[model samples]
Each structure stands twice: as structure tokens, then as C-alpha cells.
Target: MIGAGMGAMAAAARLAVAGHRVVVYERTETYGGAVRRFERDGFGFDTGPGLLTLPAVYRDLFVKTGKEPLEDCVELVQVDPCARHVFADGTEVSLPNASRAGVVAALDKALGAGAGERWGAFLVRAREAWDRTRRPLLEEPLWPNWQVLAEKEPYPAVAHRRLLRTRQARTLSEIGSLELRDERLAALLESSALAHGLDPRTVPASAAVLPYMEHAFGTWYVHGGIRELARAVYERCVRRRVEFVFGAEVVRVLEKDGRAAGVELSDGAVAEADHVVADVDPAWLKALTDRPLDGNGDVRADPFMTRPGRFALLLALRGGCEAGAAHRTVVHAPDPESELDFLASADGDQPPPPTVTVLRPDDPALRPDDGHESVVLSAVVPSAADWDEEGMVRQYTEHLLEAAEAVIPGLRDRVLWQEVRTPDDTDDETGAFLGAVPAPALAAGRGRFLHPSNTTRLPGLYRVGGWSHPGGGLPHAGMSGALVAGLIVEGPEFRGSR
Candidate 1:
């Protein structure tokens, strides 16, 4: 394995159990790729993903690789009122975790009588899309005839008639206008896509599965931090006898008999293996090999070349946790169009206060004592923006703090100190091109949202992680590892996870 990311480690553990000697070479001194923790004076925060959805992905990993279950490895707590949404129009709603009726009632109580019903109706349709594509997109390898997935849009969009003409929502923005109808409801839907660095206006209607999956599986938080989950997986890999070499970067992939046989390290040392699994980004992987990994008809590696990345603020607050505060709160932007325009623009202008997610997990492990708290604020921004400019980063941090104040009143005053993380920081850490975070693969727009196959053209080479099949997100990356292991252990005849 080329990197010790969550996906790579997951694969390492499984491959080790399958009687294959697995070795991971990570350039960083530590493991867990982007899944990292920041600490200061006993206060800690999860700088990567704050919450885990569809945790069954990890649960399955533990069950297959060992006798111990995932719950035994890490404490998983389901977050109640999964999220609190504060819309631009001052409308607020606390959505219940995995309860359709509860969510419907809350929406009705907060956004008027019929709002909840409409959102509920949308979820039913989103579930259809999920069922239609779940196997091909998440469980199975990218099919050779992948164009079938591209030509088919699995989202069952409701039809509307205007001027005696029938039309169905094709994009997420249209679904908001034609079906959702309410601006606040639309914002709620669009924010889910925006959180994943997707533009709802252009993203496929199949993207509705994003919010649906969250609502269905419920949001969960592990004890300590999400980094704890990564630590558990890393420990599991070690227990399985998988070898890890940290700070050992693979400079090039060595080929033997026209197949990927080994990797060359930056120190000019070579390690030979029967197969090579890469968990790095597409651009970085391309630089490692002279061979063409994908043919013309194959799904392109960098589908969304200019996708946005996250800008985060890790705040150490002076106050203790509030008596009744939602664990996660989304503060919507005042002008959604302006924020979207800024993201789409290539001129690198200062962005307006974008929609920000404020996470305040009430875990004792995250803080020094009862008198202090750790809060993380994140927003999606253009990955190629001038994040290197200290002034720009500072200004964006202020914008995020200002937006977070809507959810966390007196936020600035409560902050004892703050740490800022920009796309440039993500680039330095994960080596993603321009720090662009890959969005989950959606099954429309002519496969533009789909990721490349895990099996590359290079015979013994395979791809795993967010940059490969099924695309980004915690669950998807885990599934990528499972698929890669399945392909390697069972050969080309392997179907998928049962």
C-alpha cells in the first residue's frame, strides 16, 4: 500500500487476514491521512470529519477482519436531533436522527404546516435513488460498461406540468425550486451538497442520496474524536500483522513484466511485491508512474478538477458546554447565489460569509476540564484560492467566525485561542492537488461525478480511497478498500461485498 489512509489501512488489515503480507509506506510521520487531531493545552479537536454517517461500513470492516465488533473498539454515540439548521431567513429546525416522523413533525412545527411533509416526500424519492445505485456505486467494482451508469439517472424526480409541457427536475437546484418550493427547505437540501464541496445548481439530482443517507443511518460520533476511529483501525492493522513504514515516501512504482510489481522509495530503495495498491490522489499517483493507468473510455481520474476544499477553524472556548445545544449546527449564508458565485469564480476574490457548520461535541475527552470547550467550524471554499496569503486566510477565518455566531452566540468573545486550517494545509498534509476534496460519486451527468475504477490498466496496480471507485466520504472510502481487497483476494471474478 502506498499510503496509510483510513481506506489503505482498512485494506491492509483485510489483506493481512487473507494470508497476504501487506506493507504500507506513508510519507507522513503519522497515519490516518486527512483524519488528524489537533491538541493544545489538553483541548483537542477532530480536524477532518466531525461525524460518521453509515458507520456500518466500519462495523463490517471489524466484523470481517477480527472476532471483535466495532462497538468494542470504539464507543459510537448517535447524535440526537442530528443537526440544527439556522436558515438565512431566521427559520430554525432541529432534525431528529433517523426518525422520519419526528423529522416531519419538527419541520412542520418550525417551517409551517406542510414543510415537513414535502421534505419527507423528497426523502422517499431519495431512498429510491439510493436503492437503485447503491450496489453498483458503493458495493461492487466500477463496471466495465460504466456508461450504463452515466446514461441512467436513478433519482425518481417528480414531474411538473407547465404550459401543457411535462418536466422533471434534472439537477439539485431544480428539485429545490420545482419540488421543495420553500426557500428555507431548498437551502436545507442545497447545504448538504455544499458541505461536500458540490455545487447544488449543477450537481446531478442523484445527489439527493447524500442527505437521504444521513437521515436514514443517523449521525454518529465516536468517543474522544473521530481520530479515535482511525487509531482503532490502525491498531487493528498492526494486530493483523500488517507492516507500516512511516516517513517512507514512494517516489515511483516499479514495473516487472509490464505489471506493477513494486515501488521505489524517495531514498532510492526498492521494495518488491506482487501487487501495489495506491491510496493517494490522482495527480500524485500520475506522477509516480510513467505508464497510463486509464484508457480513453475509462472514467477519468480527476472528474471534478476544480472541486472546492474545506477551511476550518478549531476554537478553544472558555465556556463549558451549553445545557441544551445541538451537537452540529449549520448556519446558512445570507445570499446563497453570491457564495456560489464566489466558489465558481476563478479570480480568487474574497468570499462572502459562506454557509458554516459549527460542531460542539459534548465529549469530556475533547476539553481540559468542565470550564473549557473545543469547537470546530468548517466551510467549503475554492481549493485553488490564494490560501497561502496570510491576510486572505485571516479574513476568511473572521468570516467563518462571524457566520458561526448565528449558532454560537458570543462565539468570538468565548474563544480563548483559535487554529485555522485552509486548503493549503490540507494539500501539505494529504497531497491532494490544490487541496481539492473529492465529492462522493453520483450516478448522473454522464458519469462526470463517478470516480475511476479501482482496477487500473496496470495489471497488478489498484486504486483505493476517495480518489477511486465510489468516491469520497467516510463510508465510501471504506467501501473502496473492501472492493480493492475483494478484487485482489478473489481475483477478477469477485463480485462485491455481500
Candidate 2:
């Protein structure tokens, strides 16, 4: 295996149990690719994902590989009132965890009468889309005739008449405008897509499943920090007898007679293997192979346009967290258009402060003590190159903190010190070009955003990770690991995990 990201480690554990002597060669000195942690004066912060959704992916891994389950390794706590959304219009709503009725009532109470009814109705349609695409998109490998999923929009958009002409919403923006009919409701729906690094305006109606899945499964936070979850997976790999060679940068994937044999390291060391499971991005994988895999029938000609990387602010504050603060709060941009415009821009000036996802976990373990708190503020921004401009990064950091002020009143004053993480950090750490966060695979735009096949054209070579088949995010990456393991162990006949 190459690289020790969550997806790679998950695959490592399973492959080890399957009787393969998995030797993971990660370039970095540590494990957990982007899922890393930062520490300062006893304050700990999860530099990668702040929370976990659809944790069943990890649960299944533990159940299959060991006597202990996931819960025994990591303490999973379901965040109540999953998130607090503060809209530009001063409308605030704290949606409860996995409670449709509760969410409906909250939306109604916050956005006025009937607002929740429309949202509830839309979710029903979104649920249908989830059911239709769930298997093909998540559980199974990409089919040969994937064009069917690409062309089909499973979302059942209601028909509407405008100027005596009938039209049905197709894109996410249209659904927000024609169906939800309220700016706050539309923002709420669009936020889900934005969180995935997708532009809602162009995202297919099938993207409605994004928000539906969140509300159905509920959001969760692990005790200590999300890094603990990664640590647990790493330990599981070790227990299963997977050997990890940290700082062992793989320069080339050695091939013998047109089949993958093993990997050659930067230090001129080579380890032969029966098969190679690459958890790195496609570009990196290609560089290692020194040749392009067969790609005449791939999903897209270019996959780098998926989404931009993250700009984060890890704030170590002087005061404790407020008593009734939600674990996560979204401070919506006053001008959604400007924020979207900035995110879409490649050379444009920093657009208005983008939407901010503020994570203020209440876990005492995150802080030095009760007197201080660790808060992480993140926003989706342009690629790593944009952050290269020190002036631009500083300005963007200020913009993020200013928006965060809405939730953390007197936030600037409370900050004892701040650590900024830009897209560049992600690139240096995970080796994803421009540190772009891969958008989740969707069934629209002819499957343009879908990742490449896990089973590459080169025999004995497979892909597993966010940048591969199932796409980004914790659950999807885990699923990619399961799929790759099944394919390698069971051969081409393996469809996927049953």
C-alpha cells in the first residue's frame, strides 16, 4: 500500500486480515494523511475533518477485522441540534439530530410558517433520489455502462409554471429557487453542496441526496478529537500485522512483465509485493507508474476541477466555550452570490468573506483546561496556489474570523493565538495537487465528477482513497477501501462488499 490516509489504512487492516503482508510506505513521518492533529500548550485540534458522518463505515471495518468494535476504540457522540445555521437575514435555526419532525418544526419556527413544510416535502423527494443512487454510487463498483447513471436525474423535481410555460428544476440552484422558494431555505440546501466542495448552482438535482443523508444518519463527533478515529484505524492496522514504513517515500511502483510487482522507495530500497493498493490521488499514482493507465473510457478527461481546498483558522482562545453553543455553527455569507463567485474564481480577488463552518467542540480534552478553548474555523476557498500570496491568505483569514464573530462574539479579543492552515498545507501533507478536496461522486453532468475506476487498467494495481472510485469524505473513502480489498482478494468477479 502507498500512503497512510484513512482510506489506505482501512484497506491495510482488511488486507492484513486477508493474509496479505501489507507494507504501507507513507512519505510523511506520520500516518493519517490529511486527518492530522495539531497541538499547542496542551490544546489539541483536529486539523482534518472535525466530525464524522455515517460512522457505520468504520463500525463495519472493526466488526469484520477484530473482536472489538469501533465504539470500543473511539467514543462516538451524536451532536444534538446537529448544527446551528445563522442566515444573513438574522434567521437562526438549530436543527436536531436525525429527527425529521424536529427539523421541520425548527425550520418552521425560525423561518416563519410553512417554510418547514416545503423543506420537508423536498426532503421526501431527496430521499427517493438517495434510494435510487445509493447502491450504484456507494455499495457497488462503477458499472461499464455508467452513462445511464450520468444521464438519469433521479431527483423527482415538481413541475412549475412560469409565464405560462412549464419547467422542472434540474440543477441544485433551480431546486433552491423554484422549490424551496425562500432564501434561507435555499441557503440551507446549498450549504450542504458547498460543504462537499461543489457549486450548488451547477450541481445536479441528484445532489439533493447530500442533505438528505446528513439528516437521516446524523452528525457525530468522536471524543478527544477526530484524529482519535484515525489513530484507532492505524492501531487496528498494526494489530492486524500490517507493517508501516513512515518517511519511506515511494518514487516508483515497480512493474515486472506488465504487472505491478512492488514499489521502489526514494532511498533506493525496493520491496516486492503480489499487488499494490494505491491510496494516493490519480496524478501521483500516474507519476509513480511512469506511464498513464488505459484511460480511453474514464469518467472525465480532467478530474482536478472537482473542488478547491480548505482555509482554516485554529484559534486557541483565552475563555471557555459558551454554555449552550452548538458543536458546529455555520455563519452564512450575507451575499451568497459574492461568496459563490469568489469560490468559483481562479484569478479573481478574494471575494466577500465566504461561508464559514465554525467548529467549537465542547470536549474538555481539546483545551488545556476550562479556562481556555480551542476553536477551528474553516471555509472552502480557491486552490493552494491562491493561498501562496501571503497578503491574500492574511486577508482571507481576517475575513473568516470576521464572519466567525457572528457566532463567537468578541472572537478576536478572545483569541490568545491563532494558527492558520491554508490549501498549501493540504498539498504538502496529502500530496493532492493544489490541495483540492475531491467532491463526492454524483450522478449528473454525465458523471463528469465521478472518480476513476478502483481497478485500474494495469493488472495487480488498484486504487483506494477519497481521490479514487467512491470519491472524498470519511464514509466514501472507507467504502473505497472495502471495494478495493474485495476486488484484489476476490479478483474481478468481486462486485463489492455485500
Candidate 3:
């Protein structure tokens, strides 16, 4: 395995179970790709994924491996009231976990009773789409022996979607108009789609399934943060005797007669393999292989990857900052046009205004014993087009920090430490292509092609993380690891090897 990211980690565990001698090479002196956490003083914060959804995916992986995903250690609270949404128009909505009625009730209180009823109707339709699609598109591997999933129900039965070519074609305007009379409510529903990183106007309507999953399934936050997931996978790797070579950068793919062999490390060491699975960035593989760039033999051009890396801010605060919260709170533009305009501003002309995402570790322990509240503030800016670690101008850095402190009073004094991480950090840390969140367009449509999955490409090589099929984020990445294991052992390979 190359690049010990999430997919690489998951693939390592699965391959070890298959009785293969697995070796993982990571450039960083750490394990767990995007899901790793950092500890400073007494504060600890998860780097990439914090909110987790799709519990079944994790449960399934543990079952496949003859271990319990949750029984041994860690417990999933199955968080309710998943998130609190604050919009530009002073509209506030709290989304409950895995329950449409609760969200509708909350919407009714915030927007109007009429708006709540409309939301209920849309929920019913979305639920139908969820039942139809989840089994086929999400659960199946991209391999050839794939079975057709989701008995396609009539579109009308699900929702009234017309004149929309792809889900990308249906913008927030259509969702606002068709789904609910309350424009604010519509924005909240579509906001989940933006989590995919495409323009709300261009994202496909078929994505209605996502909000359903979150509300019906509810999002989860792992105890002690998302890093616990990495520990679980790591523990499994240990039991299987997977060898981890951290700080070992792979220099090149050593091809033998155009068949699989192994990799050459940066320090001139070569490790051989009958089947070489690359869990690193796929672009790395494309650069190494002579394969044409237009498309791979089975893979297509990835729309999610065509976007930029996510700009992030990690803040360390005293444990008590929650009481001194700033009133400026936060605001998100309701429509994609505004969001895209904000993104384009940073494309080279000027530093994009740091769109703020607030993170408060509910765990009081995140603060240092020395009176510091450590919070990691994150925002998705136009990925730093020229995010140079060394050459970044002082003015550019000031702009993001000032923007954050402006919204948060006392942020300067409350901070024991503040660091600015551009899209570059994401690349160096997880080796994600372009180092940003994958757009929904990548995981939305037919999904036959391998985007970033462990089961695609080669037999021994498996994929994981946001780039994998079914897209990115906490729950999806963890589930992907399990899915790869299921695809492998469940096959007749178990009998053949035995």
C-alpha cells in the first residue's frame, strides 16, 4: 500500500485478513490519512472529519473482519440534533439526527407552519428515493460482477423533478421553488448538497438522498473525536501483522513487463509485490504510469477532483471560550451564485474572505489545564491557487485571521495558539488529490467508474477516503474501508485461498 491515508489504512486491514503480507508506506511520520488528530498542550482536535454518519457501514466492516466495530471499544451516541444552521437572512434551523419529523418541527418553529408542512411533503418523497437508491448505488462495489441496484421508481413518486438533466443542473433556486415555499428552508435542505463541493445550481437533484440519510440515519461524532476510528483500523492492522513504513515516500512504481510488481521508495529502497495497491493520490499513479490522461480504461474524468483544496484554520483556545461567544456568530450565502462568487474572488485576484466554520470541542478536555480553549476554526475558501508554505505573504495571512477574529470577539486573546493551513496542508497530510473535499458530482450519478475506492483498479490494491466511490467525509471514509473488506472476503477467494 502506498500513502497510508484512510483508504490505504482500510485496504491494509482487509488485505491482511486475506492472508497477504501487507506493507504500508506513508510520507508523513504518522498513520491515518485525513482522519488523524493533533494534540497540543492538553487540547486535541480532529483534522479532517469530525461529524460522522452512516453507522451501518462501520458495523458491516467490523462484522466482515470477525471483530465488532463497536463492541470492543468506542460507542456511537448516534447524535441527535446533528447541526444548527444559521443562514444569511437571520433564519436559524436545527437539524435532528435521523428524523424528518423533528427537522420539520424545527423548521416550522423557525420559518412557518406552512413551510414546515411543505418540508414534510418533500421529506416523504426524498425518503422514497432513499429506499430505492441506497442499496444499489451506495452499497455495491464498482467491480464488474456488480448487480444492478435500486429498482428505479417513477420519478414523480419520489419528487417532481423536471427539466433537470443531471442533479448538477438543478440549482438551489429550483430546490427552493419546488421543495418548500420557505426559501430559507429550501436553502437548508440544499446546503447538505453543497457539502459535496459543487455549485448548488449545478448539483444533481438525485442528491435528495443525502439529507434523507442524515436525518433518517442521523450523523454521529465518535467519542474522543474521529481519531478513534483511526485507532480501530490501526488496531486491526496490528492484529493482522501489517507492516507500516512511516516517513517512507514512494519514488516511483516499478513496472515489470507492464504487469504488477512493487514500488521504489524515495530513499532508493524497492519493495516488491505481486499486486501493487496505491492508496496515495491517484494523480500520483497517473503521473507515474503511461496511461492517457483523458480517462483510465475503466475510470472516467472525476468531477469532484477538478475542484480545489479546502482552506482550513486550527485554533487552540482555553476551555471556557464557549461562554464568551461572539454575536456576529456566522452566516452562509443561501445560493450557489453567492458562494461561487466568493470562491472566484480568491482565485488570484484577491484572498477570498475566509468563510468561517466554527468548531467547539464539546469535550471540556480540549482546553489546556492552563486556561486555554482550543477550537479549530475551518472554512472552505477558493483553494489556495498558489498556496506556498514558505512564500505566503503576510497580508494574505492577516486577512484570514482578521476575518475570523472579526466574527469572533476575544478570539485573539483566547487563543494560546493559531495556525493557518492552506490547501497545501491537506495535500501534505492526507495526499488527497488537490487537497480539498470531493464534490458531490463525483459520487452522484451512475458511479460505475472508480473515483477513489479500494475495490477498483487492481485485485490486491484497495481504495478508501473521500476520493473513493460514494464520496468523501467521516462516515463514508470509514465505511469504505469495511466495504473493501466485504468485497474481498465475501467472494469465493476465501474458499480458493483456504
Candidate 4:
């Protein structure tokens, strides 16, 4: 495997079981890609994705290894997913899990009857859209590299949904502001847009799948830190006897007879495999390609460029944060005008701190009420290129703390220890180009061609990670990894030389 990111590890585990000799190289001393963690005193914090909703993926992973998921890996308890909106106008409303009825009732009480019905109607449509896009595109890998662009069944509907302007664009107190109105609900909907680094006025409706899926599947937290996912994959690979070459920085991918042969490391060492899979960002993988191939065989990963860097804060706290059965995506978003205004300029390749995600919406274990609440606030910040380490640290620490303090009184003073992970940290640590964390931008304007997808470019090579097709995000990443594995090993007809 190219890089030992989580997706890469998952792919490596599967490929190894399929009887291919697998070797993984990682630049860091540790493995897990974005699944990094930190702790101080009595408190701990997961530096990356904490709210894992899709349990089936993990279940399937363990089953593949002939092990029980809960026994072999971390146990996951379903969280009652709900988004509580604290609008600037000083109104707070919560929309809860699969309880679309409750959401409608709440909206009727807060917004309008018409608005409530509209939301329900849209929820139904969103669910349908999810169903339509689920299998053929979202859960499947682009095979043969030509089917997507060739004379065959292409995913135009799925592509259209991803590329078009989201429902957030037309409504919710922003640009279009179509029919039913409750300014508070409007603000809540708008806040959801910023929650994902998207502009409410521009993000496509498909993005709404997050809320719908959260309600349907239920939000969840791994018993320990979410980083347990990395641990599980690592253990599986080890059991399969996959060799993990830590700190082996690969510099070039060797091509022989016009097919992938092996990789050359920075230390002049070489590791050969039947077929190579890239787990880093596409741009990063491109750098290692001794000579760049067309790389255009699949538009899934290479199609969409990247988004800006994220300004993240991992604070080991001295106190606990409350989380009930349901979770809340806290967005201390400035007013709509300010939020949209900032989003427009965000692409200047400029770093601006506006949105703040206070994630432990639910999960008292991670954030105990008695004490030990790990708070992580990640916002889009200026790239490492824009500022020096000292400057970046100072900015992230001050701005994010101030924002958190407003939500939790005396938060800055309560902080026992702080570790600031700038977008630059993401790049330097994960080799993500432009410091792109998790997934890059699939802007509304560019719409259709976004999302990291497609495993292989042509016949032999495979790609997965922050820059591949189907786009980035924990589920997308995991799904893309499995799809690639399935295509290479279990697909009805592709013979990847092993």
C-alpha cells in the first residue's frame, strides 16, 4: 500500500487476506491517518472524526476477519442524533433522530406549518436521493476506469446531485430564501451548512443527506476514542501477517512493462507488490510517480481539486461537557450575512476563522459530566504558507479559545493543556496537499466533478484516501476502501495480477 492511512490500512488488510503480499509504508512513527488523539491529566480528546454513524462498515470489517466486531474492536453505542440550533436571534430548537415527526412538530411550533411540511417533503426526497445514489455510485468503485467516461451506464443522476447547488443555496435565510419561514429555523438550517465548511447559500441539497442519515442510522461514539478504528485495522493487518514498514518514506513508484511494479523509498530501499494502491491524497501520490501518468483514467479522485486548510484545536480540559442521548452540532456562526460573506472570501485561498464545531453533542463517556471533557474546535484557517508557526499558533489559540469561551464560560482559564493543529499540521503530518483535512471542497459551482472517488486510473493501480473519488469523510473513505478491495479481489470480472 502507498501510505498507511486508515483507508490504506483497510485496503491492505483485505488485499493481504486475498493472498497478495502486502507491505505498507508510513512517514510517521504512528499509523492511523486522521485518527490521531491526545490527552492531558484526566481528560482525552479524539483529534478527528468522533461521531461515527455507519456501524455496518465496522461490522463488515470484523466479519471479513472472522471475528466479532464488538469483541475484537471497540464497541459502538448508537447516539440519538439531533441538531440543536442556537440562532443569533436567541432562539434554540432541536431536530431529533428519525423522529421526523418531532422535527416537523418542532418546526411547526417554531417556524410555520408550510415550512414544516416543506422540510418533511424535502426529507423524503433526500432519503430517496440517498437510496438512488447509495449503491451504484456511493458504495461502488469505478472499475475498468473507462466505464465512467465510456459507453455504458454512467451515474449522471448521482453526479448531478453532487455537482449541483444544494438545497441550502435556495432557502434558509440566505440567497434564494424560497417559501416557508421561521427565521430561527432558517438560521439553524444555515448553520448546518457552515457545520460542514459549506456555504448555506451554495452547498448542494445532497449535503442534507448528513442530517437524514444521522437520524436514520443514529449518531454514535466508539467506546474508547474513535482512533480505535485504526487500532482494529492495524491488528487485523498484523494477524494477516501484513508487514508494516513504519517511517519508510516512499519517494517514487516504479513502473515496469507499463504496469505498476514496486515503490522506491527515500532511503533508496524498494518494496515490490503485485499491484500498488495509493492511500495518500492524489496530489501527494502524483509527486511519487517517477513520471506522472495521465492520472485521468478515473475522474473520481483527480477530478476535484482541493479545499482550504482547517484550523483545529485539541484542548485537554479540566471539566466535563454534557451530552445526552442526542447530539448537537454547535455552530457559533455569526449572522447569516457575516457567515455567507466569510464563505465567499474563504476561497481567496485565504484563511478566515468563522465557523466553530463543538462536537461532543452526545457521548458522556468522552465528555464526562464530573470532569474530563475533551473539546476540539476545528475551523478553516490560513494555510501554513500564509503564516509562520508562531503566528499560526498564536492566531488559532486565541481565536478558537475566545469562541469556545463564549459557549462555555471561563473555557480558556479551564484549559489544562492545549495542542493546536493547524492546517499545516494536517499537511505535514498526513502529507495532504494544501493541508486538506479529511476531504477537500466540492464547491457548488464546480458541483458535479467533486468528491474523492475511483480506485484505479487504468488497470493495475488503485487510489484511496483524502483525494480519491466518492469524496472524503470517514464513511466515504471507508466505503471507497472496501469498494476498491471488492473490485480488485471479488468483482465478477477484473483480474488484478496478484
Deviation of model 4 at 3, angstroms:
1.3
TM-score between model 2 and native: 0.97
Q: Which is superior by TM-score, 1 or 4? A: 1
lDDT string, candidate 2, 1-498, tens digits: 999998899889998999988999999999998899999998999999999889999999999899999999999999997999999988899999999999999999999999999999999989999999888888888776777888888888575656565566778999989888999999999999998888898889989989998999999999999999999999999999999999899999989999999999999998998899898877788889867674775654254454688989999999898899989999898898888877777556655778899999998999999999999999888783457677888888888898888898688899899999998899899999888888778887687767777887789998889988778899999988888888888888888776
Residues 310-378, candidate 1, lDDT per residue (tens digit)? Answer: 999999999898789999999999999989988988465567879999999999999999999999999
Angstrom error at residue 76, model 3 = 3.0
Candidate 2 error regions (>4 Å): 161-167, 301-306
Model 2 RMSD, rounded to 1 decimal: 1.6
lDDT of 4 by residue, 1-498 (tens): 877876777777777788878888887888888787765554567776777767676667667754556445677666554555555555555676568887788877765566667677656755764665455445655434423322221111221355564333322233224423455555555554455555556555445555556657766677677887778778888988888988888888878787778888988988776678888876777677744444544344452354556677877666566435124445555555654564455434333445566655334555545666667777654343454547646765676766566566567777777777767767777888767654422323333335543444334677776567555666666666676677668753533222
Error of 2 at 351 (Å): 2.8
* TM-score for all models, in order of appearance: 0.98, 0.97, 0.82, 0.83
Order the candidates by lDDT, highest first. Answer: 1, 2, 4, 3
Off by over 4 Å in 1: 161-166, 297-299
How would the candidate models be sorted by TM-score, starting from the highest? Answer: 1, 2, 4, 3
lDDT of each: 0.91, 0.87, 0.60, 0.61
Listed per candidate, the RMSD to the true structure in angstroms reads 1.3, 1.6, 4.9, 5.3
Superposition error at 266 for model 3 (Å): 1.9
Which parts of model 4 have CA positions greater than 4 angstroms off?
A: 70-72, 109-115, 143-176, 179-183, 190-193, 290-306, 322-327, 340-353, 361-369, 382-396, 438-449, 452-455, 491-498
lDDT of 3 at 373: 61
Global lDDT of model 2: 0.87
